[model samples]
Target: MSTMLQWPASRPARPGDPLVDSFGRVHSDLRVSLTDRCSLRCTYCMPEQGNLWLERSTLLDAAEIEAIARVAALDGVDTFRLTGGEPLLRRDLAEIVRRLAALTVGGRPVEVSMTTNGIGLAGRIDELAAAGLSRVNISLDTVRADRFAELTKRDRLADVLDGIRAAAASGLRPLKLNTVAMRGVNDDELHDLVDLAVEHGAELRFIEQMPLDAGHTWDRSTMLTRDEILETLSARWRLTEVDGRGDSPAERFHLDGGPHTVGVIAAVTAPFCGACNRLRLTADGQVRNCLFARDELDLRRVLRSELSGTERDAALDSVLRASVLGKQAGHGIDDPEFLQPGRGMNAIGG
Candidate 1:
């Protein structure tokens, strides 16, 4: 298969585009966190005990978010992806999608995507699709209901599975499943998930466990590195690497004559920052350069200020400048001295 080069060039990037990074990488992709609330409390991604969330009045409104999206499109950003603890948790989310879909980059088009836990997706998939949802990424770490309950501390495995089925039925092709590979956690179901992908024609991606929470329970011993995972799964079927999609960190591969493919995201074992061409916009309107970094600039502050035109442009300029310098050579999460941020992954819109 050829590489997916659907990105349009007519999305003209200007000198003062608010989100452009220093490496000449136009911050074309905006990952927006709709809310910090989620139903399931995953051990690695979110706190088992839960924590306080940002005040509702302080969070950006749908109109404010749409304004940011329009500004991003004007700059060169042609992709607007919605993420959250679970995007479905937001009320009137379809309306949000509808508003973002109205924005365009230059004469070109912008891609709209979303990521969800898939529990609440069944009822909302059609509405979201009708509202201009281009694609969706669903997280399913374990296939077994028992293990799923143990991992997520919820009995929504059935709903998640039904959601996947409904999404597939809705003709949402190329539905991607994100699984975090933990040694004693869902590692046993690795091949089972591959088989699930094969059965559904969906792509299953194994993401290495990342360190972000204040929970010190995460250790290297629990990590099933990407290499070990591939070696283990190779015994079940002959695998061939698929050549396409350079921006994706996943190493794509397929089983011999299988209907589906598998991907490995080696963020911890091997970082892909050099090829990183993405920027993240938190729910509070902060621009995060790197996921593990504790630094960020609150764009909400300027968006709420009395500034207009060039003043707002200058504020965004300072943010873009700071992001360039703050872009670390690589994250130090693996190092012992690397202090993990107190924030949960859900808060940052994974």
Candidate 2:
């Protein structure tokens, strides 16, 4: 763990006083990474050899994570999304969810969710839902068993499918499916994936391939853009843009004459930074204002420091404020001078 910073006492932010960046964007959604350990080695996310996982001792315990969420809730962060290389890999995740779900900000109950690869979710969906998990976003690129193995380097398509079914059966309402679309990869299975979502009454979202691969070899040439994905899907089914976008990263749409809905996150093609309201916390306790940020504030040190509860809370408020204030105007992915962050998507948490 990093050494604690010498932070002076700062006033806690009230529920109305949100964590706003320099650009006046109020951040209310927090994505916390539980761990960097994952089961599959997805080609788009990590290298085949895989990266070293963080030591268990360095990770934030369930109590520490709850404390962070409590501090965030005080500052108007109502939605907390737990993420990881694969969040289901964490054994105590249900307990963490239970703790966060008990938090209320300004009398409103905090919403707790998780984003997982769905490898181990089938058996635990009931447990997670019973523990107060509101919903889940499972990462599934293709439904074909062979394609799944080729993409993730794992033959677990059956397991993921089972998990999706379990999520719906367990009443994880508004269950979401996240697919990273690439040019010649799972792009061909777009309509099929949508069909699966429709059958399960789940919201399916196609995310553009990002440059967060561990190998740093992501080529825009091979990446499927938002327009391409929409065009392809339109050829198969009619889509109407849904109203009320409201600071969401995904552009939501509904299948014409049907109740099923789908979304596309065009991070590279259609930058949504101007309305971005999300912040990130790595498993080790670093706070990042942006997913593509080059620097982070080490809040774990303060949380683990020899300080009183009041002192730690004050320091956390200050650190969070500093990180938000330092947020860039945009991610700059489309800029000529743009460069991908050194860390991969797995390490950075989705």
Candidate 3:
């Protein structure tokens, strides 16, 4: 384990200097949460009831989100992934995407994508795509409705299935499906989930369930691992590694040496902190350096401040740079003293 170290204060960010952390990872990809509200309660994510939703008044408006994004855009961010309890639940999602899509940095149009639960996606995908959504990552844990209803405390599996088909037909390239691999929950349906992806022209990503549950009941000993997922896959096909893992969390592979592939995000077993280039902005406007970070920089407070435009921009840069510079070498989930973030994944943005 690497000892945690604090970086020296970063000077005001310049156009080319970018948001570089102590490990020399230039932060450009931003995960912006539109809201912490969702349409379904996935067993692995949210509680079935009693989630303390952020007040409407406290949430950042579209204009405020755009302004903060513009600052980050000017700094170096070119890719923004929209996340949420379910991004589709945000009423102004299309408008938000439109505004983000219009942002450009270094003469390159910013790429805007979303990670959604695919509940209400079918109804708004066309407008979102027209507004410049590059693609989407839809979460689908099981192909069977009974298991889906059991996993997600909702019997709306058919709705998600329809949404996936519509998104596939919406001309969104590389449509992806995210599945949190659980031990006794949906582990038996791994092959079935991948087959569902093949049927719908989507790539399946088996994520190692991290300790991000709202109920804080995640157990690493019982949680599914990447090697275990591959063991399940290797049962029926010959696996071939795909090159260019980049800074992506998923280690992708070709199954049966064909186009169909599976991505395993072994976040716990294999820490990829060295190549991480992403930062997160909570729905309420807090800048989180990592998904599991204990500390955050309040951008909403900065936005609500009385600083002039130039001053506010300077302040945003300083806070954003500070968040990056203060990043720990890894998430430290394996450390003896490791503690889960105070906020769950839904609250943190993804």
Q: Write the per-residue lDDT of candidate 3 for residues 1-350, one digit (tens) a residue.
A: 11223335675445435787777678889999988888888877889898998888878988989988998998788999999978888889999999999999989899999999898889999999999999999999998889888888899999998899999999897899999998888899999999999888888999999999888888887789889999999998788999888888888899899798889998999878887888999999999999899899999999998996889888888888889889998999989998888888888887
Worst 10 residues of 2 by lDDT: 1-10
| Model 1 residue 332 distance off true place after TM-score fit, in angstroms | 2.7
TM-score list, all predictions: 0.90, 0.95, 0.95
Candidates' lDDT values, in order? 0.78, 0.87, 0.88
Order by TM-score, highest first:
3, 2, 1
Worst 10 residues of 1 by lDDT: 1-10
TM-score, structure 2 vs. true: 0.95
How far is 188's C-alpha from truth in model 1 (Å)? 1.0
Estimate the Cα RMSD of every predicted model relative to the unseen true structure.
4.1, 4.8, 3.0
For candidate 2, what's the RMSD? 4.8
Please identify model 2 stretches exceeding 4 Å from their true place: 1-16
Question: Taking the tens digit of each residue's C-alpha lDDT, what string does model 2 give over 146-248?
Answer: 9889988889989898888888788877899999999888888999999998888898999988888878899999999999999999998789998888888
**Candidate 3 or 1, higher lDDT:** 3
Root-mean-square deviation of candidate 1: 4.1
Which residue pairs in model 2 clash with each other? none
**Per-residue alpha-carbon lDDT of model 1 for 38-129, expressed as tens digits?**
88988887666747887888778888788767666766678888998788988879999999988877776688899899988999999999
